[model samples]
Target: MTNFKPGEVTTTHIHSDILNRNITLSVYLPEDYSDLYKSKVVFCFDGRDFLRFGQIHRVYERLRREKAVERVIIVGFHYESVEKRRIEFHPQGEKASQTVQAVAREIMPWIDQTFPTYKVGNARVLLGDSLAGSIALLTTLSYPRVMSQVGLLSPHYDHVVESLFQRCQFKDDLTIWHVIGKEEKDFKLPTSGERADFLTPNRTLNRLISATSATYFYEELDGGHNWKTWKKELPALLKYFLSNQ
Candidate 1:
């Protein structure tokens, strides 16, 4: 097995004209990194939350050791604040278009320049959860040639279903992995009169995937919207994506 340490974590800031602010980005490099060779890259939204809550570095290390996935570089794009995060990551407003542009023009370019990455279609994967998942789906659809693989964990779908499908057409070249909890049907939120009736929307998304020429995988796990579920699902997700490599 390939033993790995925690690896290096670095932070940088980018000036975004679209959002009229600077965004901080966190990058996690695998322990077995080599600049001489290019590695597959996974771009994830909500960098700070993922780093703290998801423990992705630890998970990546374990998966690498097990040889389930190839060596990968993780790029986490952190939003400015909670308020800004919601506005930027949410796929329901005019600002959402700006946010996507910021990622494609500013964030992705910087990472491609800084790291030795495959810089191709399928080798680059986009990932997110909740609102970020919506953004990931939007971005991948908008830029299919750049991002061919999308990982969505428990996406939040209230009423954006039609717009999502209208904007992007699924092709055979794309690969998508979507998962939600079996108990997430009509799940309620504590703070407000909000709820995630994810079962129907997810099923709809799965049906769309089925109609498309894309390779798709859908699963219903035994948990709710939490890191435990995501962590448990990460290994198999990575294996599925990396198997094509």
Candidate 2:
């Protein structure tokens, strides 16, 4: 139904030594892309799935045409596979943090060199869903100056809440936009009754963000955990992040 033009989608690849994996990166440049203006960049995890399931390209095209937001460079970082995604994206262990660091240190610099980006302070943003959300949040905390804004949509909250608040350093330089579906189900542990609930932990994280003088926006949408919900929320998220421009 949707006809997308050529040059609207650009693809690249990054090899990370930290994870010992090759990551395929997909970038969507706005129609007016030129060397004249440095576009804002938004790095998103679960790259392949976001394209196939979320139809993000169409959404971006419509929003940009309507002037709902400024021009942006959407960088989609693809993981190895769905099975390995949990281990890679969950911010629960040391390896997860290592992978996040690799992305920040290695992959991002490569992108900057390859593309015409606005490498200015607070111009870059990180976005993800579910476990990828945990990775994005942790990565932002780890490199607050580099990753200034984050869009967390329906994150899985288990070990991340305590780990993020207790271990990471928060500064006023960051702006986090957190959104969770109210109807999203909570995961149950085999031995322990139930792990940390999603909504409450996100609220607690919000409170922590508020106390740290960081710009924060928390929203609870009436929906469930799926791409459909995320697709519905993407426009508003784009507006909020691009409002300053």
Say which candidate scores most in TM-score. Answer: 1
The deviation in Å at residue 238 for candidate 1 is 1.4
Q: Tell me the spans in candidate 2 whose CA falls farther than 4 Å from its real position.
A: 1-7, 159-161, 185-197
Q: For all the candidates, what are their Cα RMSDs to the real structure?
A: 3.9, 4.3
- TM-score, one value per model: 0.90, 0.87
For all candidates, what are the clash counts? 0, 0
Clashing pairs in 2: none
Determine the C-alpha RMSD for candidate 1 after optimal superposition of all C-alphas.
Answer: 3.9
lDDT tens digits, residue span 42-92, model 2? 888887667778777677778777877776778888877655776788776
TM-score of 2: 0.87
Question: Residue 90: error of model 2 in Å?
Answer: 0.6
Q: What is the lDDT of residue 218 in candidate 1?
A: 90
